[model samples]
Target: MATLGTVTFNNSSATSIFHTSSSLKFSSKPLLLPTRFSPKTPFPLRILRIYALSSNDIKVGTNLEVDGAPWRVLEFLHVKPGKGAAFVRTKMRNYITGNTVEKTFRAGSTIDEANVFKEAKQFTYKDGSQFVFMDLNTFEEIRLNEADVGDKTKWLKEGMDCNLLFWNGKVIDFELPITVQLAVVDVDPGLKGDTVSGGSKPATLDTGAVVNVPLFINIGDQILVDTRTGQYMNRA
Candidate 1:
């Protein structure tokens, strides 16, 4: 009975000591708890941290940070075999260089998540080699270098709305609409016998983008183009 009472007293004493105002108060400084307490003692401070993304959570359009570079998941497949462990196979594109690569990760592995965002901007004009875009809501102007515009320059036209990809608050890349309607600025006249399914002829659009259109297409004709593949869809 005495030993039972002693144990109860000690437990109550510990509770009182741990719950004191000074011990319970939080501070911005490093918090070190009393090691004398039991291994299961509750910590007075809670720390929040950012954990990497799990492979099982991956999906199409997922953004990741690899080797200090930003990548977007173009495609992903979760594969499981009878002989070995499961894994995820992914096709990702680098935001900066516009290069695509295949990557594999263990089923339960973790990957860093990239902080990327997009802003809507309108292509206002080209000042020398720099392309200028304006935020329609804010009217703020942003100029991108020629190299940053890359091959997309061929499809850009004034007043075209675009999505500018930003990482760490800086613009890294941009996306154009999948399809655009452009007028043919130059093309040879179609022969009399030309059919819609017949031979294709090269036609330059007002934006300087050259695409092969049906032989029936003529200068001043409006055509729909797939910006992703640079193919002519049909007359607009």
Candidate 2:
């Protein structure tokens, strides 16, 4: 299969091929490719140029050049707000960091998108200072440092799925699944009549994540948890 711009080829050998084109032909969708931007640049910087823009005007979903990088606009809303200068409320996802950030732009204001890249990888195992992951599609293994994982490392488990963010082909960030279920390895036995008071107790899961479970729950129970909120879900 071959890809050209927004179109992709399903089967080169097959006589019939599907072509998916953008409704707004001029709008450029962001690409998950390596970029060359440093992390020291300030946010809300002006966009100087865009590879997809035909003219000088900025359009939603169009990649903008900012701080010598590219960024994709996930959403954009124009607001008048009854008074003051009109502005655009934009939710942009960093292509390299896989991080979504919100910013307000003055109406008619232009800025560059950071040139970032992303790739889907499967969690393999952890080394001393790095977490290893293998690209399922590419079968290529990559190692990311602890700093790149940030706070998401606590929730990562073996054979989990994760997204690797890259800049200039170097991993800079990653994202983990929002929730994971683990078995309760140990918990204090609940006392009789504890249910009447609506009491809760702390339990340790097999993954070592602590959850507040109902007093009736005992060791060897499985539970679901929301990693994003770090809250307990129903028994698994």
* Predicted structure with the largest lDDT when compared to the true one: 1
Question: Which lDDT tens digits does candidate 1 get at residues 99-199?
Answer: 99999999987676776777789999999989999888767788999999999999999999999987744699999999999999999999877974679
User: Candidate 2, which segments miss by more than 4 Å at Cα?
Assistant: 1-65, 69-78, 81-84, 89-103, 115-117, 192-197
Task: Find the 10 residues in a row with the least total lDDT in model 2.
Answer: 9-18
lDDT score at residue 127, model 2, on the 0-100 scale: 89
lDDT of 2 by residue, 13-100 (tens): 1121113455523224332332233443322222222222221244566554444554677787778888798887777766556677
Candidate number achieving the greatest TM-score relative to the actual structure: 1
State model 1's lDDT: 0.80
**Each prediction's TM-score versus the true structure:** 0.75, 0.60
**TM-score of decoy 1:** 0.75
Name model 1 segments beyond 4 Å from true.
1-52
